[model samples]
Target chain A: MDEPPRSAPMSASVPPGGGPGRIDRRAIVDGFPLFVPAVPFGFVVGVAVVESEMPAVVGWSTSLTIFAGASQLATVTLAGVATLWAVAVAALVVNSRHVMYSAALAPTFRHQPTWFRWVAPFFLIDQVFALVALRPDGSPASFRRYYLTLGVFFYLMWLAAVSLGMVVGPAIPTGWRLDVAPAVMFTGMVVISLTRSPAVVAAVVAAAVAFLAAGLPDRLGILVGAGAGVLAGAVAEARLVNDRAITDEQEFTP
Target chain B: MNMSTAFVLTIVIALGTYLLRAVPALLLADRELPVPVQRALRNVGPAVLAALVVVSVASTADGGIEVEVAEVAALVAAGVVAWWRRNLIWSLLAGMAALWVTLVLV
Candidate 1:
């Protein structure tokens, strides 16, 4: 893959030049830990994604649309080889991890209100989770502000990094063609993220399913594999719960 | 991958990903996540990631099983770096560097 290097001045999008401090700076600062990996990761993804089949502009938008790194990358790569449905399914499953994030933060956000509930979770990425998790219990209003500020801050950083990444790609001639820059940078970050694994059964089941379906058109094999893995893992999980119940019963009888 | 398709997918994914995040916040308030549900959800991450990796590696651009040694070597380098350093940036950097080196040297 041709790793397209981003233009250097993309950093110009960083702080001070943009005087928009709606959210608390503290919340934004809280996300600093992620800056290291995220910046480079965003840039790399942008480059790889542009290298894929998607156009520069569409590739860039995944940062906001999906807002998750790994899923965004999967979306691009899958889009390159598979159909839209395949890409969509893969993106959803990859991001299904956020279901946990949403559930974990649900209690914290429950009191906010209908509109807030609807809009707030849109910003709930891993960094936001980190910031929220670390926070000492506080008033709901303060919590909302804190979360949104960090959300905005993280959003800006991601956009900028991706935008910076685009500068390295083609078609951006550096004369303030805003669309070109934004599109290219977003493309830079499309490569995406994964960090963990499961037991032998889930892996084995999923691989088998994917392999079996590998011949299906539009790369639908992975969807079948993902479904099977989930099914198998669910069975495993339920079985473990059952075994635990049996053990408890035996102990009580003794 | 027409421009319109890319645009549509981007919009759909944005909507889909957003709904995935928003629905739980709207609906799951005050309810305990059932054990089975939690377990299944937990597995979803690994299953999807694993499935993606397998399919991605196995199915080439032409939908055939062929391992590009250069890409595989880079991926291995990335996996090792990520696990060893336990840092995402370093892992990616190491992988990219390794891929570049492998491409250049061998």
Candidate 2:
């Protein structure tokens, strides 16, 4: 996907250059560890497809077409037995969190090309969002390179894992505890993101609410908790600004 | 379900999901958001990550939330390593190790 150093107009948005090759390499390295947990999760989705009696091809195709694991699991598991609308709604609601991810990323995507904007969201999974959101100041060119490289890497990895799962899924014992890996990965991600006090507030509040509302239907608690945490963090930030302003005024008056 | 029925359902779900994801970027492209919205968006990463942590580890049981001891051990170990080393791979390894050790002992 390298464009051979285009003219100034096209390349103007490029940051004080990381060299396209370097950024792609860095993106792959950064994405590798995060991508690890998805293997077992994909296996679960594959097992769901087998149990549902869906065609293996159709089950595998969802990995490419839908690309979101949770919803894919829901859709595959519920497809035949559930009402058509029920299956659709269940999957869509599971994926509704992507709306927030998209909104948060809109500003970064603002300066991207028309084609990039159109194609980029196709790969907007949780890991991609977390990685891009970490480097909010990246240039449009770098952003495109990093996002696509990482996206494709994850896509290929997921496809392979799910395929492997479909073959041996039934034989694998559930007690192997493949599930613990993703929880650990997510915990590490949360720790990495907690660089500021207000961010800590956000994480804590979000965790508390999500745990309390764990029974919410269709995973709506995820959204509800996240929204509350954002509000808490924003409120904390506004208060900090006000307090600093007050202290500054007092010093100036004296 | 028949292959054709599953195929049609897959297409429908995929289309709806695509719109949910793509519309925000297309509509808000290049537009500056309000200050409050920006502040909230800033926390979206941490907040969502935290929520995901809970979703992964906690599930509804017969009547209430049931969290496994091994998973919680994994989370604490991972959190400490992540904070101390600031490395994802190390933290992940630590958490997995902790999970297995706790499972064996318990």
Candidate 3:
């Protein structure tokens, strides 16, 4: 795969739908990259559910049914009084990015059927979205189909890992080892995040803020850090773009 | 909460989570966002992920701020793996290995 150019213009021409020949291959090819990360993360989440004193079935069902890893982790980790509300809020916040992901791909997917449209969103995880969005010439239908293929594969992997972890929960030694899971997951997220322009500064600033505010109650520090990072990145982008516009205008002046 | 209550809570939480994950895609299905707003949304994932990582590493035993060398080592290893390969599995493996080594040695 070639390294994508920094800011290539999106293709206005709509490519033919993957039909049967290309869509299946595209899905499998794109989906394979996601499986590796999902397994470890799923295992960790499974372990977390057991640690929370919840039944192993709950973990398995949650992973199998919901299939949203970050939200699942946040929900189980903070499982306490009014935990339902907290999980709801956190999941909403975390998944808010999907809207952007879907919107980015909408132009390509404008031709897909409503049924396909409705079902495609459920599988719109970060990896699926990234793969589809990065495609050189994928149409909306192709993107949706590709995402569903990835989603199905991911869902299966997640279910298997969670089940394995839940079944073997007692045998897995407890301690610092479990901590490695989140660290690893978060690290991958951070790296992917860093590839984009403005996120580097945002991540650094948010890390600093989170470190300072780590004492806040009920994991509010995470919220604060996230909010700060978004605000920082938005401000930076706004300023940079504004400055560039001014420079361009000045250059164009008579 | 009691076992039954916790079970109910878990169910509620699970449902709530699904709703959140689904809502954004559902709402923005066919809608087109302004360029500026779209750009802002683009940064959300990275920002949120970074915040999560910061909190995870900085979070202390008593819920206070404290930096542990092991955690720092893990973070660095993870960052290196991610930057070098851009592969999630390798990055995670590197971080986990770093954490395990640090834990055993320290």
Highest TM-score: give the candidate number. 2
For model 3, the docking class works out as: acceptable
Please write out the lDDT profile of model 1 over residues A36-107, one tens digit for every residue: 446655776677577768987888888877787767878887786987887898778766646656765665
* Interface RMSD list for the candidates: 8.5, 3.1, 4.7
Candidate 2 per-residue C-alpha lDDT over A110-190 given as tens digits, one digit per residue, 9 for 90 to 100: 777787888888889999998887664545676777787778778889898888888887778887688778878988988
lDDT of 2 at A249: 23
lDDT of 2 at B41: 74
Better of 2 and 3 by lDDT: 2
TM-score of each: 0.54, 0.89, 0.73
Model 3 lDDT tens row, A184-252: 666676776576456776677777787787777555676677667767876766777786764322211
| Candidates' chain B TM-scores in the order shown | 0.63, 0.92, 0.75
Interface RMSD of 1: 8.5
Docking class of 1: acceptable
Which stretches of model 1 miss by more than 4 angstroms? A1-22, A169-254, B30-106
Q: How does model 2 score on DockQ?
A: 0.62
Clashes by residue pair, model 2: none
Ranking by TM-score: 2, 3, 1
TM-score of chain A of each: 0.58, 0.86, 0.64
